[model samples]
Target chain A: MDPLLYDILVALGLGLLGAVLFSAIGLISGTDETTTIAPVTLLVVLLGAPPAGVFTFWMCAAISKHMTHAVPTALLGIPGDTMALPLLQQASALRNLGAPHIALRKMLAGSVISAFIAVPLAVLFAVILAPFGTYITASAPWLFIAASVLIAYFSAGRWASVIALVPFTLLIVALQSFTGAHEVKLGVSYFLGIAIGPLVAELISAASPLERKRMNRSEPRETTLAPDVKGWGGYFPNPFRVLDRSQVRATATAAAITSGTFVFSPVAMTVIAGEIVGARIKHAYHRLTSVLAVRNGVTESTYIAEALIPLIAFGLPLSPVAAGPAAPLFNAPPRFTVNSETGVVNNLHTLMSVSEFLIWGLVSVVIATLIAYPFAMNHARSAAAFVAKRISHEAIIATFVGLILVIGLWEGGVIALLVILTVGLVGGLLYRVLGMNTGVQFMGYYAAVLSVPAILKLLG
Target chain B: MNNPTPAPASGPDGQLAEIWGDVVSRPQLGKAILIGAVVSLAVYAVALATIAPLASTPAIGKALAMLAGIIGCILGGAICARLFQPKRRVVEQIAPGAIWQTEVLDQIAIEGGAIGSVEDLPPAVAQEMREVGLYSVFQDYEQDRARNREAG
Candidate 1:
């Protein structure tokens, strides 16, 4: 047996015990407060902790982090982070029906299920594909530019909007270039982003005399009954439910095209890959669940694949989303680096070895799920009733907005707040004024990087 | 007239429904793209222009500039494009009506039940009603399943 695996198992067992303790505290406190956990966990791991031991510790932290994030989004209307934004949006609906606990469990279950599937898969994929990782990493910048431009050009309004992308991109380049070293440039960018982001929507909100109109919206179906575990289990989307013989056969016919492309942008390809999988699965019975599960798998795979590719090939760590949490745990440096001159590619074999340690993250999820699932299911009624009775709707919104403010400022600074708002406004305006999708607008921004230079060269 | 209390159910639905329009605007997108492209070029230009002053090996400067240029171009093209694209708000929706109320649906319903039973419909359908709907969730699931089975 590899010494590493043995050490990892020992650490993992200890970490599981820690996770149980944290989960219990969270259940009682109704909070997974992160202010201290992040630093404290790091202290423990960095102070002579084994790599595998760090993995176990981090895993426990991550699962609890996910579980606790549910509290604000589910109960207080606050999303823990940008990644959780969508989850919160979905969960909020359940919260409205006064069934926040159910919403929380669903999201927790989904995340836990996905984590179990993704974390190890990420490590394995990273280890196996280490050889080709470099070529893909080197090629990423162009892919990013192409995707950006294509998305921008294809947005609702075609020519005019596409043309508009040029100046927009140039302005950004000019500003970023001009303010090369100043702290304030970021502030300026943020201001521009926030101010412009919601411009159209805010305008419409103001201009639409219809704003005064009132109507009674349908109420949510409030349920206090215990959720069916089977139904809940069914809710776990099967990632591979879509590969019927016919669709698989059809896809096999196109294997050349499928294999030809290499994915660099995990976030971008996640949807594209998911759709392709869903389409192939169309011939199967139980299309919806199958479609959903497969999509989940693709999304997880994309994240795992994209994240590991950079790590293995260029020794560059790119998964800020997952790494943001994991990095602190490993006492690992924030960024992954690969220098060409050093010819450090050989060293990758050593780093790929670290993935053996991540099995702990998978283990943590299983153990955390076992501990959390019961609290979520059994105590949901009281949890829901307690939240409903104790926290006022106004309080929830205030807390949520307040959290957004703090988080926004923390991430982008006061300037970022402005930028986000600007992006939101501009995004809203493009949709309203030009009838373009935000995706296209963002695409154009990326496209302009290529097009603007091409145009400048042509005119030059 | 007493104003009807905005039911929690209707609130999230309204939020989800309205995501498309609220998310994208041309001016904002145009600016973001412009910024990304220009920055990429500038990085290259700066790297190239300063090659002469770089001490020791001049070739090193040239190589560094070229590398930076390439990376900048790629990032400007790919990441920036993605960041600035116009998308339907609902495309960003995390889950179904069971998860959150459709903000868009509430607005439509408020205008007079023009679209009813937003809840009864599949989360996918409600997602589609919003302009940003990707419609690829199920499709991706299928692809993943195939990959997994093949791997297994």
Candidate 2:
């Protein structure tokens, strides 16, 4: 068999495997599989990439996982990745409004558009921008500061969030001081991830108190394409469809740009991109338009950036999001680092490896979208009715909180409890007293630390 | 489970936001600025003392210390605010009644091709909920109306 053919068959099979695994676990646990796949896939690559033959296997496995992750998110409220959170919101809101099928259709359409648009664009952009990357990264501190401030100002609200700016700016400087200490000691951002992580886990755990009672809920069935909303026009850049076109443009632009800048910094970029895109959309368009664009833009951008970063910058396996399903293919190692500092030609160097990964990943999205959209319309009504009858929303959220707590504990040991307790106390207070978003406050804290020192430096 | 409820006067959300504001509030704007200036000086003192001895690479060490100084300043500010006013939840008033009217309900019924049984709702509410995609909330109203009719 031709190598390309071989890779496709293997990739397709793996995608099926990923879909089955995600579906089984998602249905059983009542959590969305899409939410878990990308991180897991990246983790697989991170662990398994150093071995010669494993890189191809990891790439195939990851693409397969991305292909199927959308199912639970579109069908249920479970987002496959953090990027899918906004779509989940719109989908759930629409589900409540009795048009879940339409929402799913729209999401599938947008995902497909972005998948096709983003992958090739990211690849080309990486190729075009690769030469300048080292220089760009060197100058990233200022960019990071600027991005943080912009995100803070907008997300916190111009006036209201400004109150958070001082403290938040200081907090970033504080966190960075700590991060710099770890960097000198540990040599990279990896361990710093360890420290900053608890903060997030604590915040989520604190804010998310488990609900004791399960509430009544309905589920929407897979939908068929409505006659009016069919064909390429339905899925493509149809500028006439004002709201939908804007969603495509914003998500595509954000996703593409974010992937290109992945190596500079992931968290800062994710938050900043989300804030900027969201705020821009909010300002440029109506509330509904902004909601659609920002939601789709952030979710898709995060996913694209994760996949692109390791592949382009270091020839490493994609992030954990893409790595999990890809694990079994590379001989299921207990641990492996998915990076290629040096390698023989045609034998999967980082450059070729990532390009191949992007090419195939794009192809899978197109195929998945075609299959999902038509299939969805037929099942929409039944799926909706079944979902309504079977699942409870409150129960789902409670389970999610439980999962977060478990994950937090797994990550931070006994500290998870303290973190959660602290976050809940602080988060609750912020919620009750701040007259602003807790997420903004959280971001502001991180940004504040970054800003204070930068300002002092400027003054001096 | 005995979930602690808020006092009747102020709700949970309001109380929490207030405490956060107080904690982050700049006290006697002039005094706070003066305090910030002093804190900046202390940071400089600490930086000069620590960097000269502790650093293997003087540049990286100084950079790291400066980062530490900024962190200190923020912690100092937040701490100062908290000290100024001990953490306390403040309460505000809540308004009552359906923030809606019955006329909009009849119009919505006409538009959706449903029976014009708008008696259960005020039009203002029906209109607002519909706009926000919360129309299903009216189900409770319909249920209540049904119960009243049965009782009558």
Candidate 3:
């Protein structure tokens, strides 16, 4: 068989595998994305999968996970992941309105519409931005600071996020300095710390009487599951038709706009886009549904944009989404390593070209849509019911904990574990109390390495 | 699960302009953000002196930096939490009646056919729709028609 033919088969098969696996995992409500995505992605890299296989698996996983992740957000009144945070307002609001089934349909429809649009648009933008790669990389330190401020300003905390970046950066810089001395260079630790910040905070709070008292509710929280609405004919009804004229328009417009902003935080874009749309719609109910659809669309578009743009154009992790969730594509040790000490680049940027990225990116999206999208539509009710009723938080948390420990041991022994715990607890506390989200923290991590040194040099 | 079908893209995009018009704007997460910023910066500036020495250290500077970071975040989070007041839950305010009204609205919105006005719906539905700022379709019917004509 031709090598190209073999590669195609491998890519397609792996794409489906990734989609199926993550879709089920995503349906497990409250499952954090980084915990689920990072470990498996690292495994693919360490397993020495081919570039096509790795790319296919990763893109498919991200696209599919996000697609199905909306299930719990829309149905169970819980956010599916970090990106799904903005959707919660609408989800909960719509659920309050007794139409979680409608919210789920709208979300799934938006996922299908926006995801299909994001791929080609991301590829196009990446190609356009490719020529500026050199200048962008050269000014990365300054750009990181600017991006830090921009993203921070747009976060839920607004300007407070901007100010919070100072401490977060200082924390990261301090940790990196101390850990670097021990000869235990760490990367995944901080990512894991920020990703699991809330859980770590909750665990710590449980130990304190005052904190535990604050969290205590005498009455158990009740979530009334709305019965699935009966309308709509056929399996996998046309995604476009599921939404109204305004919804389809909002989805398309937001998807297009967000796909171009590869450098901004996905959550920020989702909020801004939804806000922009929300400001225009008069009906509170319609605004909730439309914004939910639009914001969900933004999630898919922003991820696709961030990954494709940086990988194709600069080959450097320029965006938060690129640096965090999509980090494996840029650097995963043995097979792919963007050397921090030497500035040597040997990841997807050095491994593949524009044409290959476009080809494989689209292939991953196509395969993912075929599997995740339809699966989400047809079985959303059953899936949501099962996850809400049965999925154990302990089992999920335990698995993540085990993975974090395993990765910590693999990279730097006990020190790495300490690094992750310290970062996670403090970071989680800051995250919970300060209103600073993980996306902003992820940017702060980048600014520490990329911007802080430059600021110091300028000061000196 | 039933097998999926093709999703044909809809056209006549211009009439949907009314959907984007702002009847509702999202509430900002205000004072918490300001309080968070003030508290964080104060901690960083004060703690920088203690952590500055570690910055000069060779490989270990990174680890020591994190130690200082942890200190700053805790202090900042403490101050911010004290200042930031939590909002009461409004989800509880959504009476069961509102839920039924919303379901009917969703059905109407999906059907995309002409309805005389919010008044044409049941009295409970009309009142709920009124609360959400929804009203008669006829109010903007002429504008949509014009936009649709232009879009076509």
Candidate 4:
């Protein structure tokens, strides 16, 4: 068989797998992208998938999840994931106005259109920036430090998150040395710990007597699942028909503009894009629907740009999205790695060429759109209801717990498990108290690995 | 054999708490977590003992074992799902009435949005609203606002 044909086949297979898997996962709320995508993509890399396969898998998974995530956000008034939170107000308003289906369709159409627009634009932006890749990699240590501070400042905690990075970096350094003494070097454990920090904090808080009153619930929570209306005839609804002319134009423009601003937080970008678009529309109904469309569109575009730009341009996890959910593509060790001292990279960036990235990137998006978009459109109400009624939160928690244990032990051993616990507890508490979210914590991890070494050498 | 009124129930495994983002019975959550850890670890241990020696590369063997362990995690979750139900009251919402639609529009206006007149909408948008049966709703709301302004 031709090697090129084999690579495409592998990429398509993995892309389909990722799309199908994550589309289901997206229906369950509170599954953060970093916590879910990073570890799974890491598994793919470590399992010795081809570089194209790995890249396509991540791209398809991210796109598919974003598309289907609108289901719960529109129908149940619950955010499908962190990215869906900004769209909830519009979704809920539409739900109250008895047109949640409109909100859902608009979001789906926006995401599909934006994803198509974002891919080519992101690749173009990345190519334009690719000439500076060598310089970026050489000064990666200093860049990591500066990027950490900038990302932290932009986090919800603002100055508090910026101040919190010091302790967080120190904590990681201390743990590294402690494990180094035991002849155990762990990387995935730390990622797992930071990714699952919020859950760890919540579990601990639930166990504490002091937090019992806050954590306790006397009755089950109530959620009003709105009735869905099918406005389209067939399974594959045309996005152009779903959105009005103004909405399509707004979504495309927002997606194109946001594809260049990849360094900022995706949530912030989504909010700002929606605000700008919403403020321009005069009618209240149009404002609500248009904002939903644009915000969801921005979510897709921002993720694509943030992940693709750094991967193509610099081969570094520079953006918040790159550092968090897409970290494995840049720095999954052994199979893929970014050397802390030398700033050397051996990941998809080195393995695949620029043309391959573009080709495979678009291929993954098309695969995701085919599998997730229509499924979400046709079976959203049933899927949402099935997940809500059948899948217990306890089951989800149990799965995560199993993941933590398995990944920790697989990485090193008991020592690695202990490292995960320590990092998770501390990082989780800091995130809870200071609003230094997972993205900032991920940047802090990079700082500990990259910047701390540079600072020590300078002092010496 | 039964009394007319049962004695007040004690706190025997009736502790409900919100963990992560959803509510769960505390005792059941504890059991679920235990099952998750035990099942996954047990699978990993067994795979290491059985599969590690047979594989050509130790790393590949370990990776395969981790995959099995992840599957074990999902299996454990499935078991828990079968055992425990979700702690949520899911109410299927009915179609909202005109009054509720007006209230929602009012709330949107209060949030600094412009409730523009239906007559000013573009053709495509007006067609969309008509298809969704919201064109008359918006037009009526605009008339009501106009009447109130004149009366005032």
Best by lDDT: 4
Stretches of candidate 1 exceeding 4 Å from the true structure: A1-114, A149-171, A174-357, A360-364, A367-372, A380-397, A403-417, A428-460, B1-152
Instruction: Please list the residue runs of candidate 2 whose C-alpha ends up more than 4 Å from where it truly belongs after superposition.
Output: A1-103, A156-354, A363-378, A381-387, A393-398, A420-460, B1-152
- Residues A1-460, model 3: lDDT tens digits: 9988887788788888899988988786666666567657766665556788888898999889888988878766767777888888678756665667667778878877898898888889988888888787777778768877876776667888889899889999999989989887777677777776766676566456676445433222244444565456676578787777778989998999899998777877888998898777655556667788898888889988888888888877777777777877876765676544234568888778788888888888888888888888778778876655443332233334445554554456689888888888887777677777676787788788667877788899
lDDT of each: 0.41, 0.39, 0.68, 0.92
lDDT of 4 at A85: 93
Q: Relative to the unseen true structure, what is the C-alpha lDDT of residue A409 in candidate 1, on a scale of 0 to 100?
A: 38
Rank list by DockQ: 4, 1, 3, 2
Of candidates 3 and 1, the better by DockQ: 1
Best candidate per DockQ, number? 4
* iRMS (Å) per candidate: 18.0, 20.5, 18.8, 2.6
For candidate 3 chain A, which ten residues in a row score worst on lDDT? A391-400
Weakest 10 consecutive residues, lDDT, candidate 2 chain A?
A211-220
Model 4 over residues A1-460: C-alpha lDDT tens digits? 9998998788899999999999999888778898899989999998999999999999999999999999999998999999999999999999988899999999999999999999999999999999999999999999999999999999999999999999999999999999999999888999999999999999998989999888887777788888777877878999999999999999999999999999999999999999999988888888889999999999999999999999999999999999999999998877788989999998988999889988898998899999999998889999999988999999999999999999899999999999999899888888889999988999999999999999999999
Name the weakest run of 10 consecutive residues (lDDT summed) in model 1 chain B: B15-24
Chain B TM for prediction 3: 0.31
Summing lDDT over every window of 10 consecutive residues in candidate 1 chain A, give the lowest-scoring window.
A330-339
* lDDT of prediction 2: 0.39
Question: Candidate 3, after superposition: displacement of residue A324 in Å?
Answer: 2.4
Residue B143 of model 3: what lDDT? 49
Model 3 interface DockQ:
0.03
Q: Is the docking of candidate 4 incorrect, acceptable, medium or high quality?
A: medium
Scored against the true structure, residue A8 in model 3 reaches a CA lDDT of 77
